[model samples]
Target: MKNSSAADSVVLGPRPQYPIESVDNALRILLLLGERSELRLTEVAEYLGVASSTAHRLLAMLHYRGFIRQDRRSKAYVPGTALTGVAFSILQQFDVRQTLRPFLEELRDETGETVHVATLDGTTVRFIDAIESPRAVRVASRLGRSMPANCTSTGKAMLASLSTERLHQLYPEEELPGLTEHSIRSRAALEREIAGIRRRGYATSSEESEEGVSSVSVAFPAEHSALRLSFNTAMPVSRVKRADIKRIAELMRSTVDRAAALLH
Candidate 1:
């Protein structure tokens, strides 16, 4: 008679069977590395319920394939350069709007104001995602809109990350367009504002992008190739008092840092 345990192992329904055990194990190791910064061979073996020798072989194969690297002194395995390259490629293919929607929504709920994610496209910053405030009186959504790099807080945040030579290349004209009287109107003034933004590690716009909207933004570090991104929260000038700018900016920076960590 067939063993009852063997009978239980066989599925009677439409459940798919994972036939490649080795590939499944390797994929699990990759996921484990992605979630953790480093792991020792013993820890890996214990976690995977495998013998030390088997764990070593798996790790050796992974190291050979450039998915992980062993530290010279600690012997702990960390993500390798190849893994980073693959991660960057995946991020390039991923939709920014979908990735940032939850974060932007949280920010909007936290501040009761509009939140946006934007990226630099040549001399302009384009809004790729936005979460509108629930308040009756709130800033209008700027989704699918583009603004001059020197006019908006999100734009300025991205602009602050660029080299001076790159900035000059983008804005060769002496005078720049202003959305309002508050917007930076000259290259020298815009450069000065960018210097301040770099020093502060965030950017702010006071009725510069629009007549009454004020915003604070922070730029994400370029950990992924060709991805220059920033996020911002905007509120009406009446709602954001002069004294509240610093506090709001700090909060925005904290949120952006969290988002950056998740993406990284």
Candidate 2:
């Protein structure tokens, strides 16, 4: 999995009423394990945007819970019995990631950009899976990360399906936090953009969530008030021409349509 360069990445979604930093950090550590067989203390610290000592405590707790085990020699933590058991149980039921990865892969191949499958998680959008573009210059995958619904094309695409009252409820604040200067910073702006998304059947962001990155996205299960889903093709803003955005958005819209049917 790929991540934004920012080490101090915060949850960009609507702030939780009773957020627990420790639990969130520990969950982040588990997410990192999905991309590698093992993790070092330093890597966890950097990824979680925490100090090495803080990372160590989180790792120790996970190790005690049988979710991870530190290798005696390398001091790297690997998945443990409890984690494996949970994975086996989940996979046996149905692997949503496995079922949807091919669609993202196809989108990446068509657009020559990183493709992500994200789901609405309350006021946030969670990237459940992603396929990175193989190009030397391209946006990185965003697997297992969540961002504000209005800050990302993937999030906005889904948010467009929601009613104004619903959106207002989700974003009760007049002012919204922004990751970059280009991000939507108010409820009115987001609602206006969402109106355009509804008209265009797609959503876009130019350096909204991250500097120098732009993306075009389409949502599935069109207008679903619940379980709204979406995918986006992200690339360097410099490489994103108007023509390319149109081409990519068309392809993504079609792919998402098929995916919505298949998933249903």
Candidate 3:
């Protein structure tokens, strides 16, 4: 028994004891990259509060794996095409568009608005599929477009799924970007908002992304994949009242559930 205990301790020593802090820092770096097109090594190091050498090491590793890249002439780092490629592969690998087409069409039919399927790409949301309404006044989102997480209902739905510990780790206690007057600016306030979203089971945005447009979103928990899928319907503010938003949430949740089932 003594020998066995000693052997077990050696094996478990390699296991992570401080996963939260490390992951939190890693996520912060990713979030910063999402808001900007590119960053230099010194800029990333300053942002992470690490030594320049340490940050360069981390950046180099990410670049090596195709998660990030640096412009040769500008010497600035940008989110690599690897992420976009992975996003494409994810949709194709799961054949999500083919499986979810019926549900998306149904959502557009019921809401008379533009419906979209989006996935979390790092701290941004990327639209995988979209169906536009027949009305000329309806809002529309382009496929493959990536938007800031703090600025969209679909992004908020995914953010709502993370734990408070995880959320703080993502935003940190320092400066959080505000793209519009309605964007979440403080980590604490955002945490409360995220908690409320978890309780309510859906997310909403009113002109956070763009003025005169509103959206509501829900997430789908598919069995086979660890990643959650989310969908949203964008409409003109004139056409999207509080009750109408609620109805859209209901329709989106139902459709997402069906899509998740088929996706799995």
Candidate 4:
């Protein structure tokens, strides 16, 4: 994921000579939440390298301060109003979402399927924007959600653009975390898939990230663009067929080409 907890987020400056442990730990949790939309107490503990009791205390303080709020059922800590307000302000400073939203809307209109514009964050892919399909029985929007890159077409599309050395740095281990039985489970398997995506110039997923959700994704071209995002169209499993893929891939590729032109 985009976790410093996992990916060592750039710290920007030398370590402080007189660091306060509690304050540092609290900031680390916030950083992790920036990469992940939700976190659990156990995950917080492991990420911070702290005891369960200590992690709980930090989470309680943040929850009290309204930086985070626990889900009613899941009990996972999610961004609260205060944190979201800050994030919204930061997003305004970077106009990627504003720039690509129209392409997402047009793709949804053309395909009558859910469309998303997502960017890779370390080993994760975060859905930054989305447009829902008009159909009553369509895949739902995954806006603001993050998942393993190898498991999603959006993530794979972006990952395939990375150099081989970069790919190794991201997946140093042979074993990979799987969301479902169909997810790519080994680094070898993932590498093969990445190679295929590079040749195909697009990517596809069939219930790998989530059951009943299959998608086609084309990474926005890098030409004249620094933004690394993908154009994705998702549909229910029953609605997807082999014949549907070539058509969807063509639309995804053309749409991304047009969106990429706007970056200049």
Best candidate according to lDDT = 4
lDDT score of residue 98 within candidate 4: 90
Off by over 4 Å in 2: 1-93, 222-226
Q: What is the C-alpha lDDT of each candidate?
A: 0.79, 0.79, 0.73, 0.83
Ranking by lDDT: 4, 2, 1, 3
Q: Which tens-of-lDDT digit does each residue in 127-168 have in candidate 1? A: 877889899999989988889988999988988887886577
Report the candidate with higher lDDT, 3 versus 4. 4
Top candidate when judged by TM-score against the true structure? 3
Between prediction 1 and prediction 4, the one with superior TM-score is 4
The CA-based lDDT of model 1 is what? 0.79
lDDT of 3 by residue, 32-144 (tens): 66545467778767766778897887787778878787765457776676855775686756667777788888988898889898877646788888988899888876577
List, residue by residue over 1-264, the lDDT tens digit for candidate 4.
222354256488899999999998888888777656578999888877888999999999999988898876557787776776566445536887898888888888889999988876668787888899999999989988989999999988998887776576667779998899999989899889999999999999999999999999999765445346788999999999898898989988888888788876
Q: Against the hidden reference, what TM-scores do the models get?
A: 0.63, 0.64, 0.67, 0.66
What C-alpha lDDT, on a 0 to 100 scale, does residue 120 get in candidate 4? 68
Q: In candidate 4, what residue range of length 10 has the lowest lDDT sum?
A: 1-10
